[model samples]
Target: MIGAGMGAMAAAARLAVAGRRVTVYERTETHGGALRRHERDGFGFDTGPGLLHLPAVWRDLFVKTGREPLEERVAMAQVEPAVRHVFADGSSVALPGGSRAGTVEALDAALGPGAGERWSELLVRAREVWDATRRPLLEEPLTGAVDRAALGRDPYPARRRGLLRRRPATLTGVARAELRDPRLVALLESHALAHGLDPRRAPASAVVLAYLEHTFGTWYVRGGMRALADAVYERCLERGVEFRFGTAVSRVVVEGGRAVGVELADGTREAADAVVWGAGGPVPAAGDAGEAGGGTGAAAGRLTVLLALRGRRPEGTAHRTVVHTAGPGGTTRTVTVLRPGDPALVPDGEHESAVLSVAVPPHRAGAGRPADRAEAMDWTAGEWAAVDWTAPGAAERCADEALAVADAAGLGLGGRLLWREVRTPADTERETGAPGGAVPAPVLAGADGAFLRAANRTATAGLYRVGGWAHPGGGTAHAGMSGAMAAGLIVEGDDWRGSR
Candidate 1:
């Protein structure tokens, strides 16, 4: 494995169990890729995803690879009232976990009469889309020639009585036609936006994203999401997988158009029968992968603010609160305040740890650069570690803006400041090796298959791609699923159907 990311580690553990001598070479001296943790003054914070959804994806991996299930290794609990949405209209809605009816009731109570019914109806359609595409798009490895007609056809049903000539094909369309209320529309769009997607352009299949979270429920690891990564890493170690941290892979060593090994930064080469691109570090020039062109555009970046407060989290506070900031037309700017259900995140009972994550647009497009994906920012290795977030007080200013938005949304943070730390896209790029520090969005079914990701089976016979940048696309669960598919392809050969 080229990198020890979540997907790479998942595949490594399975391959190790399958009797393959798996070795992971990570540039960083850590196991988890984006599932990172930061600690200061006894306060720990997850720099990556705050929570996990559709945890069955990981549970299945643990059960298949070992006797002990995932829960045995890491503590996890469902977050009740999963997320509180504070819309632009000043009204808020706290939606309960894992209950469609409860969500409907909450929506109706907050939005208005019949609002619940509209959302419930939308869920019915979303469930249908989920059932249709969950198999081919997710469970199986994408083929060289994807069935554009099948996957492109949006599964979300259109309203019968909508003021339109035909059914809406995009998420924004569905929100406008079915959810007339702007608050409901904002709620629906927030799901896509949270995943670094533009709801206006995202296909209706994106509805599945919302359905998955609401239906399966959001969960928090006992310590942090990083704990889950630690558990997976431990499982891999038990399976005898060798991990070489602080090792940088310069390129995949290819011979006769097939990846035969990887060349390390130190000029040493280790040969392998197969190579997996687990940590999509840098795009190799053509390689044997036939130019590697089909991959989706550059990804959006996450801007997170970490807060260390002197006060305690008040009783009965929502675990997660989203305060939608006012922005230009069609732009979704949300400041998600995450108060982990796990108390271990805080320094003590009196202190609190709150994280604010804002999905910011990518840097402006450079001259001659594709407008869709921009790699305008220039960064070098080790720059992220010494990033001057305090230069001109940008970090503090951003934190104040987030806090102000939160206060406007009825969640006040007045006079509770101790200090704050900010992580930008440049930091993400340096840490994860993602191009342009862009965080890729999960692949969705849409017209022209525009949302399709690069095939796991590249042109190179032995080289394969996995992780958020690969087929089935981004999101924690999807990344893990990509690993399962990659391992299945390697173990079962090209004819492998998938893991049932």
Candidate 2:
């Protein structure tokens, strides 16, 4: 397969279960793609995606893989205040758990009277769309052909008469369809930003996002995320899947419009019935000379960061300082801070660092020489360059950010700093072949990009897709589900395609 990312792992497990002799090629020594882990001394850190929300996807995958049932590895925990929104106006409110009633109540209290009612109406409407598309889009078998299995269930629903009446459109459309609260609208639209997607461009069908998270609830893996990846890898070995870690696949061996095998960088060609592009493309680095060539292991100009922090995070808003450069004038820098989890990365709890990530500013697409002075001022880079967690400067940076949030949210960070770490975008991209160092695969929102993503069916035949890069979207939510659907397509045949 192409990359042994999350989607590729899911697909490989499913393919193996269906009795296919799958051969997966992963460039990294570990599995789990973004969910991979790293360590220094005794401190360990989860590289990407801490919160495991929308977990029905995993449950479903376990059934197909015939492993120790999803419940054995991960259990569902319903946490309240799904997230705490801190506003610069010093106005902050914690949104309750993913429930229609709970959300409305919280909105009403936080926003105003009748605000809850409006939020309820919007979600209720979204719930309907969720029902209509859940089985068809999320669960139903893949057709392996260009067909709308969803539209098949209702060929004559007669609801397509008007554009406004169609189901699963966009976030804005859904808000207009039911909600009047701008705050409520922003709350629902948060998912787009969470994935680094532009909401204005994402489709109304994206409304399904809010519905899915609310109804399904969020979860945390019982252990760290790596355990889950190891489980899947173990399953693959049982099913006889071979892998070549650290050995990059230079290119897909394509001929006569079919991908028969792959050629490793050292000039090794391995043939197979089909090759699944599970591994991500080449590493993204600054000034990558060969990146422009556009092939396997050649992608450049992007990066992701991972930080390992140890010691107890300040309690009750002890963590602070996640910001995004704003407006047309600001650079594209996103900084996120998360408290170490209850399950520490090390035997002693003093090993986890509050994780922070900053994407390396890309060189101007058509610029000459190196980045100019103006570009440097406008673009943002990783915070680690400026702050040292183990040094004296970390205290200043942490306190500065904490105080910023205090002024913004009216919430005080009461504890002293213990430990810290920072990751540059370039570091992540170089290690993992993620383009632009994008995580959770930058949500392919908006009309223009609706078709820009990689499809389950590539230009080649027999090859299939699964994982974060699949349709419906990314995250643990889509990865496991996409794998299941791809498996169904391979096993059931493509006779039912093109109906929609």
In terms of lDDT, which candidate is strongest? 1
lDDT of 1: 0.78
lDDT of 2 by residue, 1-500 (tens): 66666677777777788888877777777677777676765656666666677665666667767746876755545544466654323344566666677777776778788978876666666566566655555565434334332333321111243565464345555554456555555565555545554444456656656666677765656445666677767767777777768778777666666667778878888887776655443322212222121121111122223344334544554232344333232222233444445454654654444454332232222222213322222222332122112233322343344334333443222233344344433345566665434444322233433412344555355555555545434666677666666666666653323113
What is candidate 2's local distance difference test score?
0.52
Off by over 4 Å in 2: 74-76, 140-182, 281-336, 346-353, 356-415, 440-452, 496-500
What's each prediction's TM-score?
0.92, 0.74
Candidate 2 Cα RMSD after full superposition onto the native fold (Å): 7.3
Worst 10 residues of 2 by lDDT: 291-300
With candidate 2 superimposed using the best TM-score fit, by how many Å does residue 249's alpha carbon deviate from the native? 1.2
Candidate 1: segments with Cα more than 4 A from true spot: 161-165, 281-298, 330-332, 363-396
All models: lDDT? 0.78, 0.52
Q: Give the TM-score of candidate 2.
A: 0.74
